[model samples]
Target chain A: MSTDTVETIRTTVPVGAQYAPGSLLDWSEALVPGDIVLDERVAPNAPWSAVVRAGDVLTIVDVGGNQSADCLMFNAHDTSERYSVPDTLTWQGNAYVREGTVLRSGLGRPLMTVVGNEIDRQDTIGGACSKESNTLRYGHHTAYQHGCRENFLAEASRHGLTSRDLVSNLNWFMNVPVEADGALGIVDGLSAPGRRVAIRADMDVLVIVSNCPQMNNPCNEFNPTPLRMIVTRNEDTVR
Target chain B: MVGARDTASVLAARADARAQGSNVSDWMPYLPAASSPFAPEGVDPSALVWAETVAPGGYTHKVVARGTRLRLEDVTGDACAHVLVFNALEPWERLNVADTQKIPWQAYLGAGHPLLSGEGRVLATVVADTSAHHDAFCGTSSDEWNVVKYGDAAPQGPSPSGRALLTLAGVKHGLTPRDLPPSVSFFQGVRVEDDGALAWQGSAGPGTYVDLVAEMPLIVLVANVPHPLDPRTDYVVGPLRVHAWRGDPSGPADEHYSASPERERAYLNTTDYLEARGL
Candidate 1:
């Protein structure tokens, strides 16, 4: 046998949950007692949307390991000013989104701020997968497969948004690294089961989430899983 | 397998044709000798390498050398020029619109801003701009959306979509549809309001133009199509005039090279790469 050895660089490993699905009542450690307002589990390859109130916290849980959650945000009052990847990345002077990063809007206003993070990084590039891109990247056989763009369209349509309203979005738990020569690659995720990140709404924002259904790339490890979303409101700050 | 003899004869004929000069004109560099009337001021007419007018709903692709300045003019008041840029040496390193907007710390692109790459290098710089109406947020129009808006969105049909046109342009360069990314649009504008609403600002007027100096060998693709946000019922657009001339790339001595710490780093990254390659 050859003396060469292959070394695998594993970025993510299974981690136990800090707050399991049935343990929301015990989340007083993070939020005040009885502050849990909404807790919903989004199925794999599904789309979820909700209006996260200003000052409220929305926690996203990677229930199943290596799931990519493609997300878009807009000002709840006016859907026109949406999440701006350029503003967010430029103002932060960083490519990856992490704890303490303020997600900015196209108007250069803060839409949400990451208060807690468990994963190493998040993606601001690596736009949501679409049928056209899927067909291009894979082949014509995948032209009709459901994609994140369709999920976004289906969810956004409920709010009266059209295809023209879609914008480049954020990818939580997705690992997209830019090489030294500026080659963008969507590789395996850096998120593990039970890992979570929490964001506080700086304004009343409409958050849309599409658990990425991309089976063509390693971003989902060829197997997508469900995600959990929990909204908590502080009693002391309730107006 | 069914027609082995015919296939062999066809291959022999193709080889014979290749041995001659029959395939010499398969693809030729677009090096036009004529000068353009719309060439911007300060551009030497003698140094111009290409000049052409792309019809409405048409597209064009060209690989320009480093330091080549490209001027795109809206001949009519309703034209939207959707453009994509890629490093000619390595097509994988294309324009990163997010980095382009963010690194400059300005969401609204104008003169003096550099189009950055994902690896923190300056691919091109907006040396001159008169049409302040440009968009870095919304990309080009899609075929499905175009079909919904118009009756048809075929690449050869009337009212061609920007994505379809760009795809064709990419195909001409041995690139597939996946090579196309979210592009930056010029001559049409969209601004976010105080209430977080995106407001569409149509073209400024005829003859409005924007100039870009390529900091690296770049494959630039442009599609002159109607803005997706345009509220017009008809697929109306105007022709786009393109002019390119040899120019000097920015260096450490340039004022824009040190405009900001971020920009300085990007410029340094670009220079370092070029120096390493002895280019």
Candidate 2:
């Protein structure tokens, strides 16, 4: 919450720096007006879930490049039916979800499909952190710090849901790769400022998101930042 | 199986860690340890503990004593019980995956493996596993999947989701979403190939089962469903039967302990804590 803590959110990389977020500025800069239904800015480490109707679109903007947006989805009509990581990978025949990939539910149905992506690939295997995990991975000092689990709990409670509803999540703009030795690494993201991903609701669905607050891993570069959620429809004409 | 020298080191390390504020590092050696297994003096599940069948789209949570043997048997094939465990006395201590894999150097959970807590304490051990390859990493089914695959919307033949069921059960225990940690999916199968890719497979058969013996008092939760990766087209998977009973105190060495020195050390650490507290 402090300026010093915020400063750690992102340290500008010089042009052509090894992982300088390249060309992400184009999406944010080139974006024109569309019928905006909902415009919300999520804080550095907050959880937000909403219903996105079929034919509607949800655009996630990385206001701060490298911020990881951990997400989970369910059929708005049936909370029991939710996202399936294995089906998405198996159906797409790929591990890392990317542009044009369909986000499948557990029964192998499409809940939403990625129509746009500024980040190259999203993480499905690497999971969100919790107080217990923070204590386990970083140390006891971090146990008191906020995490996605807490964010999800605070947000999900408003919907009458609890831990049983939590599942594997999608990490947009986060870079986690399985290594040659089969070891998993949470590395610094290739996403730059203004980089974004857009998903079209294939059916009415619930989208829950946690602007990850993890500072221990490279995913956020040890600094978490805010994100923007833009819900829009193609039929809505700009006034 | 814990050697005398091992017990001494466990005590010394724990004391040293406490003095230096140990939860800050990979103080695996200094993590909380369990006492000897709890052996129910005289308790019958059908009478004292618990015996119940979880129908489709349902789950349950209960606190049972150490030495409790949790028998999970699927009435039909392709059943999954997503489970999470916590130390009943100290709720803050819950299962931790990072240590489970790194400590025993096991990438895949198998019979004779200890389910670890954040502090590297033992939560449960897979003493018996008839379903050889239960999913260790993949999670459970969800709402969108149920609708997409079965056209069952919520509030009707609502899709079956282990996550949702777990939550409904968690509320009864006063556990919140923060307590909903990653779980061990039972009765499912997933295999990692030589190319570093993961493959999804179905369960063994009806009646396939696994038994978990708690090494300490445990708050256990179960989600009755199939793995999210289950290639079933139907939303309805299968029913599961859970039977809890007391275990043998003088039972042979912990399966995991006898299997490896690392695991034996883990048990020793648990014993050190129990002994120090004089439990």
Candidate 3:
């Protein structure tokens, strides 16, 4: 749990400088399902991108529900310092994460804080998907299922990370409950058709994700959807 | 006929019992009885192997895993099990609608019944349950999964079709993105639908459960990977005897019991190979 006394302010009030719809451009066309979009104003992955200063709000919107977005965050200055899920859970004292949980780093430091949430926050416990796995679980015959692994590999290419960098991830919009018997369950989306979660970068962080495109189960009801991103400048910056 | 008052009274008692968590079977789905915790011999502790051979568009047994094998008899004949394995370790991997489409498996498997994965791996096999000689390629759906080829023209009861079974498997396995995998169905037959329209046909039945063997150790991982490719056609692996640990002074159980030097040497080399790879 963080004890740092930081004044909180709402950017929605007083009409903060908004990244208008048209003004905002996706590097990829139309932000379709299974695509990754990063705002240029913030730090990018690898070569250890510069730290995003305090009060920077990052918004990731699931254009639809039941779509999973894997996320990972790291300290900009310290390479080893990374996000800690256990600490985040303890900090909130609640298993479910919503608008207001400040994600702590592995070093017990604040990395990013959930500023605003338009949808039900997802699971941090579930990890990402891959291919060799695709073959092993399903029979060898249906081996070519395109999934999040391909997405991460594609995205990681830009950052110079091969398979090594792929580690545990946060399945945003995914809901997993730990049962009394210590069993884990993947529940349906509590998020509506269209939902979004916003986080303020405490520092320049490296985030990676694989917009999950799995059709095997009802997590997405076999229909992959899209997502949008918006970065808003603090209201004080405008006036 | 039991009068309306009697029926209503019974229903009320059943509901009250359920609300209090008392076990009752009046409203239970297709099963002889509520699953019991006790395991019978020749069966695995957490799994049920089906005996009857099912075809495309066919379904049997609502719940079958925890300690019994519901062997499909392949009643009508050869069929395919277009299955999807989920994660009992992490239930969130159970299934995803958008993911299926985004990955384009929805289109590829829409009528073809592609298997899903947690962490991206094929989790189950879809064995045919109906007789239409359905193409080995299409995927299955929910609402539009209307064409069911039954043995006889009886009342069209809503049974758990291949699609429903896939969903149930996802729930049972606690599937998630991490446990994800591509899937294949057994006794496959069906034409691919360009627009997702399914054409039913003849299929295998009774005495078929894919006879899937677990390649992994953990229940969570085991639950997600579907059954193996048919042994008759595909390359088959082992009926391996696993020991509690490596380097046991007794060696592997089989070798220890048989006192076979050859088996002991095989175990030693395998251990060395694994250690060399840092696995």
Preferred candidate (TM-score higher): 2 or 3: 2
Candidate 2, residues B1-279: lDDT per residue as tens digits?
145323357777676557766333211111121211222224342333656666666676789887888877776875678888888877667776545654455545667878877553677888888787676555555555556556653522556566567666766778765466556788777665544456776778887778888888889988777576667666656777776776742133545565755466556555655567665
Per-residue lDDT of candidate 3, residues B1-279 (tens digit): 245323356777676557766554321222222232222335543343222212233333222221121222222244344443333333334333223322222222322232333333222222223332322222332222222222221113332333334444444444322233223333333332222223333334433223322111123211111122122322111111110111112224432212322223323432343346552
Best by lDDT: 1
Candidate 1 lDDT score at position A82: 78
Candidate 1, residues B1-279, lDDT tens digits: the string is 245333357787776556675232311223452445555577677899878778888888899999998888898788899998988887767777756764454667788789876545788999888899987756777665577779888889998888789989998998775466568899998775432334678889998999899999999999999987777979999888888889889877777878877687677678777889888
Model 3 has an lDDT value of: 0.40
Return whichever of 1 and 3 wins on DockQ. 1
Best by DockQ: 2
Candidate 2 lDDT over A1-239, as tens digits, reads 22123233353632111222232222252122356777787766778889988878899988768888989888888876777665576556456778888998766689899888877778776666766555545555665666788777788778777665676678899886655334556777989878888888888889999888776677776656667888887765211
Question: Worst 10-residue stretch by lDDT in candidate 3 chain B?
Answer: B237-246
Candidate 3 runs further than 4 Å off: A1-53, A235-239, B1-279
Candidate 1 structure quality by residue, lDDT tens digits, A149-236: 8889899999998664676788888887654323455778897777788888899999999988877777676766677888889866
Q: Which stretches of candidate 2 lie over 4 Å from their true place?
A: A1-34, A46-51, A74-95, A104-109, A157-165, A179-182, A204-206, A236-239, B1-63, B71-107, B111-132, B137-188, B192-197, B201-211, B215-279
Q: What is residue B38's positional error in candidate 1, in angstroms?
A: 3.8
lDDT: which is higher, 1 or 3?
A: 1
**Prediction 2: B-chain TM-score:** 0.76
lDDT of 2: 0.68
lDDT of 3 by residue, A144-187 (tens): 65556666767755665444344345677776554432234455
Find the number of clashing residue pairs for candidate 3: 141
lDDT of each: 0.75, 0.68, 0.40
